[model samples]
Target: MKLTDLDYARQLDREDPLRDFRQRFHIPTNAAGEPVLYLCGNSLGLQPRGVTDALQAELEKWARLGVDGHFAEPNPWYSYHEIFNEPMASVVGARPEEVVVMNSLTTNLHLLMVSFYRPTPQRYKILIEGGAFPSDLYAVQSQARVHGFEPDDAIVELFPRQGEKTLRQEDIEAAIAREGDALALVLFGGVNYYTGQLFDMGAITEAGHRVGALVGFDLAHAAGNVPLKLHQWGPDFAAWCSYKYLNSGPGGVAGVFVHERHLGRADIPRFEGWWGTDPSTRFEMGPRFQPQAGAGAWQLSNAPVLPMAALKASLELFCEAGMQALHQKSARLTGYLHELVTSIGAGAFEVITPAEPEARGCQLSILASGDGELLHQRLMEADVICDYRRPNVIRVAPTPLYNTFEEVWRFWKILEESVS
Candidate 1:
């Protein structure tokens, strides 16, 4: 629909099923105390109002129960991580046994690598996207170094064809076929952090497995933003940070998924710790390490109770408003944003993200012809909180939970003024 069609936009908002959810979050305001059009959920989600109370409960537990809080509290701090499993699994389309909440994103990536990326001399290379996040690049490079392989030789980066902004599935498949025999693992972000392109995970996994390579994903930007089927896709492993689309706070705990098929594989070596030992026998202080079955075996230490509490609160909200419903709203909202940006014409800005709705999440990455940061600064000064990436990209994500159609229209109006 044409973005200038204000009546139609209002009708869309009125018909929006998830519209009521906006009230649940605390939208930030300018010094004048008016609600800011917050389109930065792709970076950091606005905090849900209930999160403070949930966190306070954990604080009260700590204050009242002392050291005994681990086992004696209302939601026992010892098994606090378990509270997140089912809802988290449901969010990602995985079984409860396949998922576990643990440390931060990069840390989980390293731990999953310890078990999944066992590189032999003959098959020592890893495949990743060309412009992967810096943390992912560092982790992959370090993993290669530990395996006695040069990063230059062991890391294969897939790039887009000349003049294209995103990688094609056929190209990704061809690369996997050509290098599959020598590749130990295939790991890519589920959605490109910069370009906002959603990779075909199931197809990618099939192609990688055909050549005997383990497949995994960093779903940091994709987890709650896009629909996922990690278990059905047959990926060997996956990891994600909850801070972005999950609406857990910054530096929030992350989640990992290990397909149940691998649960019984004792040969799969891990960086083991006592927290991963069988819960019933964990207190025995035994010499042997009997890792818990399923993804729980990946746990390195007891979970942080406060973070878990906050996560629990957010996931409960997601559970009440199912991901399917949110995804429906996301598709339309992002489509509307895309339409508005295009209506502004190509000379002012170009969308770097995929054009097809199926190819991306809610994020519409606009590349300004010149002075992108200047335009971004102007938008911020106008109390519109979208984020700017280096060189030229400004990413605006209309989060389904809290953003409205009117806010999206207001963002573009401000953009039009900035560019004019």
Candidate 2:
């Protein structure tokens, strides 16, 4: 169906299995009190309706039980994190033992690097994408400095060829092969935050392993938005935040994945804490540290029950909707947005996100030739919410879970009016 046809959009919405899911979120309205056509799920997702009750239940538990809340039935604070195992594992395509919901995104990256990015004199360099999220860049640079190597000398950054916006898997593979034994780790975003380009993670993981390097991904934009097979892809470690595509509220708890092979390895170095100690003998106050099995061993402190309760609520929705179903709807939603926007702004804007559906998730990055922020403000004033970058790019995300086809059509009309 043609993207410009309102009936086509309405028809798709009517037929959509997940259409009712949008009503479950509290979408923000504009200054005039109209519901803003929000397309910023890539930054922060809308809050779910069940979040208030979930948080209140934990508050009541804390008030009534005091410290004894740790042992409460149904959702004991002591074992609350365990409930996420099955659902989270299913989302990332990993074994239950391999996944654990824990600290924030960058914090988990730093923690995982403690164990995985072990650099020897011969294998001391780290390879990464050129324009990674600033947090990952800072984390890796500081890691190199902490290990007594100069950041410039120990880091290898791969950039796109002269005139391209996205990366080629071949270029990444070539860099991994060329680095050989000097490479200690390969870290890239599963989806680039700014460009919204998804990488070939399986191929990158293979290339890193071929050169005896550990591989990991920052899946802030990719996880929950796209289907992942972290265990099958065989990356050594990975981390992501739940605030974006996961609909878990602002600064929601993040998660981690450790390959089962690394679960019980004593030789791997890590920054340990009391919570990560073996649960069987945890309260015994044993002198020696006995790390728990699986990714739970990486925990440094007790779980944050309030935020985790909020996460649990959103995850219940994802588990019900299923990632495969979400992804299929996401492709259709994003493709329609792409077609309509391109047709309307043909000579003025170019799509920088990859055209291939497999190489992207729900976002589309449009590179405009004029005042980016002014255009963004125009959209904002019109209640068509989106975000733009420093130079000349605006990013729009039509999230499958909460966004509608009619919203995408409205955004196209607003862009036409704003640029005209």
Candidate 3:
């Protein structure tokens, strides 16, 4: 495991079970015409090789069949969304009936909140993580305001204990206990976008439910990077976008999960549309709205075929590789990145992400002690592509599907020279 061991790195790559997956993606090359070391999958995953053909087929269908393409084409636009159900369900650890592919991430978050965040006068408080993504904070705050409550009074943010970089299970449990009586909902990210901390979803859900609060998760950072069990964990709802680790292209169709227990609750309120109505009775033009049985009940419109087509292409690759195999490779690749970065001696840089493998996905956030941005710029100049968060924190993710162990080593070698 020595940092200088090139043979060791190559050996690891040779033994990688998912090594063949790298060829399936189109890695970007630098201006000098060399393939840049890509470690930014946590932001936007590299495109799959099959996406071009998947999209081309749709365009061909449009040209040939015109309006009749809805039911005449091979994949058939009328039922194209249905083709994604099984693969998506397997990815998120849910039954087919409990998941749906739909609108963008924030839109789905708003729709889920409309149903799950039913704050009563006595139980009107919401709990969220302190360093959540800004969009999530805004959405939750807006939901509280529309219900005639002050954001500060109704939303409780749980932060890490003093001197700690991440939230602890005991601290989270204590907060739920203190606010459980008044807490109507508990919503948090499955993985912290900044620090790359993967929260304990099952335990948190249990703690929230103990106090009669509904639990939900924003799985943007965790969806394809980690193994999840949304159905078994019994979260009331969860949402994620497909652009990042899912590699479906930017602004692709997102996904949502709802537990089967909520399917029969006709009284649960939601913002519905024609697509969510019962299919058989939908075209009848009935005055009364009867929602579909499961997660489809949350849909707001007809499926957008282009984004869904790209998503389907990426998902087929995921289905072939399998999540468990991908995660197994991911753990070692990220661990190697962590070890190399930390071995570069103190006063040069520090890693803010958790050391425990179980507590993170693929990302590793490093806080350079001085001139962090300068070091990041140097890495970019060397054609090692990783993202830098403002002020501090350089985020590098060795995604199992496309990144190689040698790429991880080279990124750190560049960092060592830049700091020196």
Candidate 4:
């Protein structure tokens, strides 16, 4: 049977090992109470069914124990963030000591930059993708300014060659080499948010170190969406938000990774806070700053228990599903979507995201030939939920956790009709 046949899609879903995982999420519905065809996990994932219970448990603890909840039994509020260490480390491929759940994505980026993006008068440049997410660009520009360097001069952006939709690996490596001694920090998105291009992070990290620069990643679009080996890749730092592919609630607590080599070092200049102090010395209220041993040393405030509770729920799901199995299913899901979209023909849309699975995650950015927003509106009206970027791109991610082949087939039907 052809891929376009509805039964064929259904058959694939029936055979999928991860199909049962779909019921674990709270699928959003339409006016008729039918589940919407959701293909936007790259932006915001569906809420896990367990989130309600996870949050209520914390709320009850707050009410029952009040101030004592901080040290109370059964997931004490004080050390709540510590629970994420092993699970989150497994998601991003790092040691527990190297990972910490902390401030929001951009906030963690700025904090990590304080210790990693140290710029000298001679080597003060920062390199990033040309169309990086706005928040990352803003943070890097502001950092350049604070260090007494002009943003235009200090910031170097890598763009794809003319007519190309994504940057070539060689071009990225060459750019890092060209910067040579002048490069201070090489920060790039683990996956580009707009084009859905996954950069060669390991190669990028190696090149940055060769030039005597620190390297880091803004993994907002990557953490739970892709299989990452942060410890093996060995970037100086990395940060990611939990709300997207992780299926945590909106504005959820973010995560950070600091290479173990950088932890427990006194020479590194970090923005100190009470929470970053050693737990033994923390209650002592000492005047001196005695830093924590690992990534927790970057924390400026105590754990946000409410948001962390939500994150804990999602991370538990990830641990249960296993990243390896999730990734395998993601490739098949996105691959099927790609095949369906390509069949719609070049007259309607062109996929800007890389064709290779290794070079991307679950997202496929369709460069529409006509009004992209109008197409987006049509999809919304049909109860097909996806996101449209400015200009001509419509990004759809067939996430493995909840989305299925049948949904991909239905989305193509709607997209084909809308384009015609």
For each candidate, the alpha-carbon lDDT, in order, equals: 0.92, 0.92, 0.90, 0.94
- Candidate 2 Cα deviation (angstroms), residue 88: 1.1
| TM of each candidate vs. truth | 0.98, 0.98, 0.98, 0.99
Q: Point to the candidate with the largest lDDT.
A: 4
Off by over 4 Å in 2: none
Off by over 4 Å in 3: 1-3
lDDT of 2: 0.92
Model 4 C-alpha lDDT per residue in residues 1-420, reported as the tens digit of each score:
988999999999999989999999999999999999999898888899999999999999889889999999899988999999999999999999999999899999999999998899999999999999999999999999999999999999999999998999999999999999999999999999999999999999999999899999999999999999999999999999989999888898999999999999999999999999898779999989999999999998999999899889988889998999999999998999999989986788889999999999999999888899999999999999999899889999999999999999999999999999
Compute the lDDT for candidate 1. Answer: 0.92
Off by over 4 Å in 4: none
Question: lDDT of model 1 at residue 210?
Answer: 97
What would the TM-score be for candidate 2 when compared with the true structure? 0.98
Stretches of candidate 1 off by over 4 Å are none
TM-score of 1: 0.98
